[model samples]
Target: MKRLKIKSFLGTAVLAFLIASCTDILNEEPRSVYEPGFFETEEGVRGGLTSMYAHLRYIYGNAYFYNTTQTGTDEATYAQSADQNFLVMDISGRGDITPETSRADVLWGNSFNNINTANGIIENGETVGISDALIAEARFFRAFDYFMLVQTFGGVPLDLGAGELAFNDNPVRVSSRNTVPEVYTQAIFPDLLQAVNDLPDNPRITGGVTKTVARLYLAKAYLTFGWWLQNPNNIPTYPETSRSDPDGNDAQWYFQQAYDVATTAIDNPGPFALQDTYYDVNWAPNDRNSEILLYADHTETSEYYNDSSLTYANGGGADNFAVWMMTWNYTVLRSSSSNTEWLGDIESVRREAVQPLGRPWIRMSPTIGAITNTFDDKTNDSRYDGTFTTVYRSNIDVEPAISGPVYNANGMEVAGGDPILTFLDEEPATPIDYSLPPEQGANVGAGVLPGRPDFVIGPNDISRRVYPGLWKLGVYRTDSGNGLGQPNAASTRPFNIAKFSELYFIAAEAAVKGATGSRSARELINVIRARAGMWRWDNSENEERIEDNSAEMVAATPSIIDIDYILEERSREYFGEGYRWYDLIRTQKWEEVAGSYEIAGDNYGDHTPQTVTRSIQPYHYLRPIPQGQLDALDMSAAEKDTYQNPGY
Candidate 1:
């Protein structure tokens, strides 16, 4: 594959803005500096492909849809910053949301932009007699884009082939609102099948799409479709709703299709396998591990592509948005000259003031009966470690409180020396300067308590709150590290993920559902449990180590697994990854999980609580198609209803 320098596209919003002086100074005539004919050469193709890849970066890059939506929802990553406050509101059922707020818009736009670029390459390439492999690559990319679109918004406006100037001026938008099966039949399945047939087994060297990547995408599509088709949870229209469709066969058929594709992909393992070590699997720079069948290649040089920056404090004032909000109360502290402590001492003190370093916003609420009941046995499982970070209190030796106070129920300043917890052991015994000159003895700040003695500190400590006096540990560094560089700074916190563990659970589910040919359901589940470093069901030799095998031996094991173990395992595995909210909805246990609270917290009194009640109406399952989109479409009532997902 040929590498090219990253260049801004002429028509892109960023580029256009950069070039434009002002709206009043806009030129009427089009600039013809370069022709499409010039872009037909090998270098041109390489540059075009590079541009295409850059667009893909926008989909997966920082502030992109993948980070915003996937991380925002219950797929991966937790929102740690206040900017991601929307996630808490959504998960906790405390706020109203419109489609406009969703990353769906950016995802839809970017995916289609990629598709259009791919289409341009495919269409124009034939005239120049470009390689069949390149054409196949384009087709593969187009198919992948369509797959993403279909999954998010069912039956999107399918734009196939090309268009003329007249047609482009007034594009006749197709209104089939194709069934889930139809989309698979027409767009995804066929395109992938064709691409797999034509594309090379390995195209990494060729700078193009590969059969292996195609297979992974196809398998993932099938798996997602199968779950959607077979599992009633995928259907937007529930039986309790008026918009229920009695199409039962569609679900089963999709599931079967999914199984077939996934099985094929699994059986024909190319370069994909699970990594042995967790750190090597996830944290490594090159995600080009044997396991990553499909992934966007990232490089340090690539603009906005670095993942390492996400974990550390950037010198810039901008906070590490994700880690700051999600990791509970974490902060940074600077040592003053008066307190000439080591770096270790500074970090130690900072660590103490914070409660749990990680946030519990995306946690599986104990209210979810299935999750709560199963994970109740937290001692034996290694999953619990991933779910919760144990907070250890520091052994900071301070003298016991000396106090004198008395107060009535009514507000009154009673006689008292509110217990003073002395931070320092004693004052310097042999003071060098018992009475220092006025010029040398400057007041820096008070001690750890109020009305305490001030000491001489450096100029840096004077401006910034370095001394113990102004230290509000909880409030301090609540934001990610701002532009200013400081020690023990707060940026993004690396939190727990349920990636590999969940895969094991998925494999178990597939086995239990009779999808795995060789392994029995119990055996598959046992393998998963063992992989997670948990106790095996069959290790009955010792009472201290063995798990009760009675549950594993049942005929209704899969159902029981779904009802009890699986949910709990999910909770334990994916506590802060944001899966809890959706899992509750899928299991039809939202009420049990979040019924006690009101929909909105009352702000009537002085101290207004932010607590809100959970409400899962039928319409809540699928968000309404944006009101703007609905208003724009000049459609008949019947057509509108047909196009909209059942609830919306």
Candidate 2:
């Protein structure tokens, strides 16, 4: 049981990664015998393990990975930044991703680098004198990296440490891609199996990876292998699809294995459970709840993200990464800035402008069309409004009292003026007939009717529009004092990686795929619903279960189960928690899943209409290997040709 104070320890790992120079330079792929002796020591082995886990920071700490996984799916789109042109790659076929794509490069480089480190520990396990538990931990980390690689860039070089390469050339030169199935069978499965056998049921430290986490990953790996085995998706790459069954991979068998492994993790009862309410899941200050299975712990000292140059000066940390997914930065009609005359009280004005949650970087936008229509029952679904902010209070006094100043539609300082605040849903009929406009000085932007002395505060001009701001992860400070060094740069929000609610979705999906039979899909989904206060399960949990609940509540009995029902249930439970894209990808519903949405105003809703049409392409199943890696490959053109992902 070693203490895993791996936060500051990760700094060493980050330093090890020289900024990947897209073409000629790649992240370090250790020379065979350069540091062999160091890994032979007990302390060295521990350091190696910590550093290996530390590479995950490059993945979770930045918005790149999150956006790579989320944006362009039916769930969300990246903001239209003047410089962020690559943002188009997520949703539309506009961007032809290549080796130079920064996202692809970091993911490919860091994943392999971590795996290479894990290989060092695993290869020197006996000499290092580290216990079996440590070895198991290392193996899980390696398998986890491969899982990401295979999912992103199909078959990557399946390199396990060879204490010394048979040929002493460059190590990463083997950018030779393997088939999708090969990465799984060779690296993911064997490594996870080693992890399952050697790791303890739970780790000694909080935030440390546990055997349960390893097992869950194993289940997902198997599920992925099984699903990808049949070539269900990847239609554009038809005959040459990366098939595995013919290469001795059993599709059905792995599905069952996925279910079995997931079941074991699910029934483990090791302090993890679903929070009774969705809000409680992201409610900071309570991050160590039962719902979160694995997360990158962020502190000011050991920050998850540290590159804020993307949004503002001094604004890069794991907290800022969460802000990237937020709808926080809309101050177009925010009371503090929107109010010039100060007609409304301070509190009401503040409430009208800001949603009081999530500092909106608006870098990534969640679509309003999807928000209104995605839910199975928009009215009954608690997540519909709870997850998105559509209605906003008006900061200005839209309607005046009897003695208030009256002005025509134009604000001409009439004696009676109405308070200029109302719900977007219940907007005033006559263009907010403000006879006298609130005197916002010329510097401030206000509305005035043409040729009319009585100026009007028109809704069309102000930033008050009915769009959904993502509030799934709550707000950090939205000002320059955002605590991440820059004002309104990043927050103290911890980025969530996995949750128990997802486990339920995994189980239900596994069940739907004919893998598990422990619970019907309805029963599993009903458990989540009862927690969200959406709908109660039929069979109520015992009094004891209720006492230990997220809100001290329990589920009732279940009903008939089906796949469609489970999918929608997932939307209700884990809307913006970074699960949508992967879910659609795995379910083979990308085409119908990502309806082409022309977001006119803003991803955070600047009162613009959104257009959604089915927009998934067959070639999207696998992202292209970053061209930088391909150019760096010592292999021939033919080799590179075969190695690039299909259709790329």
Candidate 3:
């Protein structure tokens, strides 16, 4: 009776097919290939489904896609490191991404691996009495791959059947990349709608696709597509430009479709439900709960480890989702400076393990505002607390050195190794509040709230005091509170790619955009708000207010249904579960929100000023086609040139 950890199933017998060892991604098979009749039996179908999941896992499980999603977005503060390639991609900003840049190559070249495998299953599912359920599962994954591809690269090669690659007897691989709309029409929609239509009534399939998963993805696809229809310039050219009218006609229809599908998923009452506690969706005991519709399934035993022998440097434990997001280079490490005398290990109390629960990458820094006021009921909104650690506990392997001339928490110069430290949970929850708290009220700047600065922090700026550590995935050594079982203690936790609360936002967005769903935008949103422990606002109030806990519990509510308000709610709920970048892109707020990433540090103590802008451009909307793939395409020079995305 062990929990089926989403990352625990890496090495089991049947699912071994999920692990692909060779660099030869999508164009061909994995280390092991399923020969001809593999899809004919129940076992085979299940295997096929696992293989597809494995391929999908390759993209989301680690930092690749996650890092790309945050960079310049409002949801992230740059944690620029020289070695992390993807971080540089985010740092590169708008026009700087040449075809030579690796961003497109990694995403584009490998994604097809998912698409082609799903194709193999769909085309041959019926051969060995594969149930309609299994067929639908295959289609659901295929749709999932295309949806991501279109969003990432404007238009990509859409292969519904065994791609043109299989047809040629001779092997000079050449293929045409489809236009974005063509992808939506020819691949994404056909597969998703069919999966939705064919899936059985049940939604509980344990790492496999279910009826609700398909519909949720369908709703998402239509919603993202609707954005392009309204603002064609947001994307490059799509083949079906005729269908996207400037008038509200086509855009409204797409919005309605998104609304309809998301509403059905919500109203149907499938296994997916908003968990009473927001953090449960990502942590154990409930990582595999109903709230998560789409996720990479793993089991407790199948732990991914970073084996040095493996060809890939970051080997083995590919299952862990936290590695890509965490930045736990202890701020306590004191380095020696050249040409300057020891100058007494200078100022600042040791925040040795200020955020010891998880190794934070410090990449996705919530803006001072996001940490403080994004939620009207900041305290009640369990999401803020669930997603981040506002406090630092005294938990680290090394004690601060008893150096002279260093100021501790009290800003006093004590020389001996001060063995004392405080553990504060949700300290300074009035995080970055715009209205400064009363001088005497709420213990202003006390304890860790006013602790010393973090040493040598992010590559983006390299030094700073503290920002709340993203604790959503910070299950340090399974929360043992020490790095003891770390290094290979399971890194893979339940990573939710899609959640039930999103349906509420989808319905809300659709309603605000002029498409009515099964419920009013306010009503749909209220359900999510209530679960997060928020309060409702009076419709005509000059400003929002709850009962101030003077009375029994209540939920804080927004005055009206507007997209900006909805966006903030989404930020509060979905934080680091990985949707910030796309959410901004779809909403056309990328420029305004994540406009310029900043990098400023060198000497950042509690108040020595931090932040300097990084590059971001409008055309950054679509990532470039991986130059390697475009160069590798089996097409004419002109055709290949056409295949590369607009700028890069």
TM-score of each: 0.57, 0.75, 0.75
Error of 3 at 126 (Å): 0.9
Q: Model 1, stretches more than 4 Å misplaced? A: 5-53, 61-93, 124-136, 160-179, 198-213, 230-234, 237-250, 285-287, 302-325, 332-516, 534-560, 563-613, 624-648
Find the candidate with the highest TM-score and give its number: 3
- What root-mean-square deviation over C-alphas does model 3 reach? 8.7
lDDT of 1 by residue, 1-648 (tens): 223443333321111111111010111222222123434554444444444544543443223242333232222222222233244334444344455554445455455445554555665666666777766777777778777666556555444223310001122323334454555556677778777777776544422456656765665565555555444444453222222123444434443444455445555555455554322333223244554444333332322322224334332212222222233222221222222222211111123212223221221111222122433444344343323322221112211211222211111111211111111212333322223222222211212222322222211111111111211001122222322122234222222211323434444444434454554445545544444443332111112343432333343234435433555555555443334544544444444544443111111111111233444454554444544444445678776666666544
- Could you tell me the lDDT of residue 337 within candidate 1? 22
Residue 10, model 3: Cα distance from true site in angstroms = 20
